[model samples]
Target: MSKILVTGANGQLGQCIKELSVSLDPDNTYLFKSSKDLDITNYQQVLAAFTLENFDFCINCAAYTNVDKAESDTQNAVNVNSTGAQNLATACNQTNTTLLHISTDFVFDGTKNSPYIETDKTAALSVYGNTKNVGETEIIKKAPKSYIIRTSWLYSEYGHNFMKTMIRFGSEKDSLSVINDQTGTPTYAKDLAEVLIKIIQNKPIPYGIYHYSNEGTATWFDFAKAIFEITKSTIQLHPIATEAYPLPAKRPKYSVLNSSKIKTALQLEIPAWRDSLKKAINALP
Candidate 1:
């Protein structure tokens, strides 16, 4: 039985993995660790933890996800995303553990009109994006057996996310204005967790960068509208350009990822964004 270690256990994707762990391969032993349990930025601590467990695989879900906060809090972002990733990669290499690191779609500047492939040139526009890009680079350089999966617009039942925020606002506010210009696919953390586990269980797949998100593209406005529709809320939803509702961090204009590579490699059928959204909404309390 392969022993697995999961970082950022309290986060959305990690929580989803926790919830689904029981249903996964019973032979595999799973260990979930939060930032309190294991600080990935501290190299010695990370090395000690890996030494103790002798983990076969480490799924890194920990990240500084706040786009706007990253602008002002640049140091913390670098510490967690870049340095932390470097620590994990180093530890994983020493322990001979395969690392499965999560990344973001923000690595790209979103200038391309078509869906982004794995080999596309990256030019991150925000501090969060830049740090995540650095993390990916560090992992590639440090770990020989590593997989960097770049996902977009991740949401789940466990944490603070776009879906939950929209649901709350739909109930509280009479009307809402969401960004229509920015387009990307919303990824369900549960689906992503399943895929991550699948990659671990079904070995011998190409290990490098891969894009994974729910099928189909939608703007933030479309996503909010769909949330209200699924929840049977009558809140007035307005579509506005990014200029009307400015954010501290500049978002990608179009960050839709082309997931054809992962699908072909894994022989997996990814669910549509709307379908997964409905499932997520139904699962919500």
Candidate 2:
């Protein structure tokens, strides 16, 4: 049995890992720790956790996820997203454990007007994006036997994500304005978590960055509309340009990531964006 340690047990992706672990294998060797138990940013804490657990693999799901809020709090974002990841990578290196890290599509600037390939150059548009890039770099530089999977537009039943926000607003408001300028793929955290598990179980994960999300592209407006449609909510979604609705942070206009690398490399089947959305919505309360 491979001893596995999962960081960020409280977050969406981490919680999904925990939930999936229950059915995947009750006897599976795994330890789930929330940040309150082991703050990844602290090198001593990370080292102590790894020394105690001596895990064969470490799946890092903790992150600073506030997009707009990251603009005002850049240091905290960098600390958690970048430095915390670095600490984990260092600990993984010292512990001789494989790392499976989660990353965002925001690492790219979305200037290509197309789905970004793994080989494509990355240019972050927002503070969150920049710091995530730093974290990705940290993993690449520090961990040799690591799998960095970059996904976008993630939402899950447990977290405060786009789908949950839309659901609440749809029930409360008659109409909502969503930006149409930016485009990306909607990745269900559950789906992502399963993919990570499969990668760990099936093959020796090659050390590099790979992109995966549910197939298809849609703007925020399209995503919000899909949410309302699936929920049978009567919220009118008004599509507007990004300029018309500014936020504290500047997101990429088109940050869709290409998953052909993962599909062909891992021989994995990717679910459609709408199909995953339907499942997520149905699973919701």
Candidate 3:
């Protein structure tokens, strides 16, 4: 039985992992640590944790995810996303523990019309994206046995996300406008959790950068409409271009990822975005 360490345990993906551990992971021992409990930026804290418990794997879910706020708060973003990742990678390397780091689709500038492959040259547009990109680079340099998984449009029953935000707005308003220009797939945190567990179970898997999102693509407008439809809501939805709603950060017009590499490597089938959205909505209490 492998002893696993999960950072950012209170976040959406981390909570999904915690929930799955009850029934799906009875054989393995897991240690879940929130940022308050173990700050990844603190190298001493990260090193001590690894020294205290000889962990076989360390799954890093901690990140500074606010896209707009990151534009102004660049230092904190760098502290957490870049420096924190470096600390974890260093500690993991010292302890000989395999590291699995989470990344974002924002790493790309969204200029490509086709789906992004693992080898695509990353040119981040926003500060958040740049920081995450640096974090990925740090892990690759620090740890040889590491996996960096880049996911997009992550949502679930647990945390603040696009689905929950749309549901709240739909209930309060009779009509809503969503961005139709931005294209990407909505990934259920639970599905990602399951994939991570599968990687752990299938030891000695290939170590490198990978992309994993739901099977199909959809714009924000499309996703919002599907959510209201699944929840049986009557809110009128309008598809607007990204220019209609101005925000601090610039989003990729099209950031769809090709998840064929991970799928082929693991011999796993991924669920469609719409299907996973239904499951997430059903799971919500």
Candidate 4:
């Protein structure tokens, strides 16, 4: 029985993992820790935790996710995303633990017209993206046994996310305008949680960078519309270009990831974005 350590246990993805862990292999023991319990930025704390638990695998779900706020809080973002990642990787390497790190599609500049593959050159456009890219690089350099999985537009029933935001806004507002130009897949956090567990359970672990998101593509407008449709809300929705709505951080125009590598490696079929959205909505209280 392998011991699994999950960081950022209170976050959406980590919470999803905890929820689904009941159905996981009974032989495996899981330890879920939030930032309060284990601060990844402090190398000593990370090393101590690993030393105490003797974990076989560490799933890093901790990240600085505020895309817009990262513009002003660059230092905090870099500290958590880059330095924290390096600390965890170093700890994992020292303890001989395989690290499964979560990454973002924002690492790309979104200039490509085609779906992004794992090998594509990264040119992050936002502070959050740049920091996350640095985190990925740090993990790759520090931890030899690491699986860096980049996902896009993550949302779940738990925590603050786009789906929950839209649901709340749709209920309160008579009408709303959403950006239709930015395109990517909405990855359900529960779906991602399950896949992460499967990777550890499966043999001949594929230790490398890979992409994982619910299949298919949609803009923020399409995503919001789908949410309203699923809830049977009559909120008026308008589609607008990226320029219609501006934020501190610049989002990718097209960040759809090609998940073929992960699918083939795991021999699994991913659920469609719409299907997963429905599941997430139904799961909500």
lDDT of 2 by residue, 50-129 (tens): 99877999999889999999999999999999999999999999889999999899998888987899989988999999
Q: What is the lDDT of residue 165 in candidate 3?
A: 96
Pairs of colliding residues, candidate 3 = none
**TM-score of predicted structure 3:** 0.99
How close is every model to the real structure, measured as TM-score? 0.99, 0.98, 0.99, 0.99
Residue 43 local lDDT, model 3: 94
lDDT of 4 at 112: 94
49, model 3: CA deviation in Å?
Answer: 0.9
Model 1 misplacement above 4 A: none
2 versus 3: better lDDT goes to: 3
lDDT head-to-head 1 vs 2, winner:
1
**Looking at model 3, which ten-residue stretch has the lowest summed lDDT?**
197-206
For model 2, the stretches where C-alpha displacement exceeds 4 angstroms are none
**Candidate 3 wrongly placed segments (more than 4 Å):** none
lDDT of 3: 0.95
- Per-residue error (Å), model 2, residue 208: 0.9
